[model samples]
Target: MDPTGNVGLLKCIYNIWKKPSKKAIIIYRWAKKMHDKNYKHIPIFLTNKLVVNYGSFISLNANIGRNLDFRHINGIVIGDGVTIANNVVIYQQVTLGGKNLGDFQKGNYPSIEDGVTIFAGAKIIGNITVGANSIVGANSVVINDVPANSVVAGIPAKVVKKLSY
Candidate 1:
């Protein structure tokens, strides 16, 4: 049996069934697909259902890449127009949201690059870029751009370490 074939499919199904976060992610993916296919009403309904049932609010407009891994899903709010790259891991209570309320604009949300790990309770606000392969420490408030291959922590997060790879 090929691991990337039926076995992988089954494992993914099992994981989704066992985790609420994965279930929410799957639902969001489905909604996004439906939305892209011009099936508007159903996607809106599904998004509403997910927000009500899972405590996770993900904008259908957010562009997320492959292998989006969520450590926990509770209180995760991903705002509109946020772009997330591949292989990004996010923990609980994380907010990738706008800086100001009732002041909408294009490119107002954070752009998370590939291979980034955002720990629990991290709030990444406004139009900042979290560079590839970087780590956002838990409970950190990030208001500025983070360089690639670095670790950032503390309020108004600053680079604490630069990773080699």
Candidate 2:
């Protein structure tokens, strides 16, 4: 909470993200463990944290890379066998889980690549793959496979923007 405008806060945030502090990693692991215990509570606590602020009640088995940046920890559920790359930013109310939770199956999870940014209230299920540098908008429900450097939105997550970087 900075006294200045949003830009200053964003800049400060960027700086911290550029080089994640030891405290941040520690907190992230702590949050991960907390998430393991209670995915519901982790988001609320994570949102307040300067580091990783995420949500949901799930057993995330993703390969989360280093220097993660969780913007606004919301109602996110990361299931087992999922993978998250570096510099990935996940917003509130997102779900990353298996398609069939009741039917247990190995190696069936979502894979989120590097430099990805998932907006608030998005739901990603099944054995889908979110390409690198992709963006999933708020409240979008993703069930299909998203291309690299693309922006997906809407009820079923349609690609709206194609990132050229």
Candidate 3:
């Protein structure tokens, strides 16, 4: 839907056709749906193809909400068990994954809340929740929970600025 409350299927189709990021998301969504239904082989193949083509890997087991904008799809990685809410924009080379193989084995993953914008090369790891409406800076490494409506930066992702809205 547009700002004018208008919805057009043709416009959406055009977007999917023109945007590689949109096409990648659509492929992932379909593959995830198939994986959820216990139809494994094709989904795995499709996801693998995405990885090979886009250098992005979004685990089918990950729970992602609506309107996820893959700002730039290259080198993006979203691991299994991660949860992302609506209206999130993720830039290139961003990783949403557990800290180690042990954490992955334990199904520990980061949960990103709504309206968050993760900049390029940022790594959000461990069992932490990034609060809603927060901005994660480029190349930042987040290992802890981020408070709502804040901007975080640096190696450990300290809250550098608090947002009013």
Residues 72-104 of candidate 2: C-alpha lDDT, one tens digit per residue: 544556666788888888766678888886423
Rank order (by TM-score, best first): 3, 1, 2
Q: lDDT score, residue 53, model 3?
A: 90
Off by over 4 Å in 1: 1-12, 102-104
For model 2, which pairs clash? 39-56, 43-54, 46-53, 53-73, 61-80, 62-82, 62-83, 63-83, 74-92, 75-93
* Deviating ranges (above 4 Å) for candidate 3: 1-8
Candidate 1: 10-residue stretch with minimal lDDT: 99-108
The better-scoring model by TM-score among 1 and 3 is: 3
lDDT of 2: 0.73
Give the winner by lDDT: 3
Let me know the TM-score candidate 2 reaches against the reference structure: 0.67
* TM-score attained by model 3: 0.92
lDDT of each: 0.92, 0.73, 0.94
For candidate 3, write residues 1-165 as lDDT tens digits. Answer: 576644676777886878989999999999999998999699999999899999999999899999999989999999998999999999999999998886766978999999999999999999999999999999999999999999999998999999996
How many steric overlaps are in each model, in order? 0, 10, 0
lDDT of candidate 2 at residue 165, scale 0 to 100: 78
Candidate 1 pairs with clashing backbones: none
Report the lDDT tens digits of candidate 1 across residue range 19-69.
887788888999999999999799999999887887889998899999999
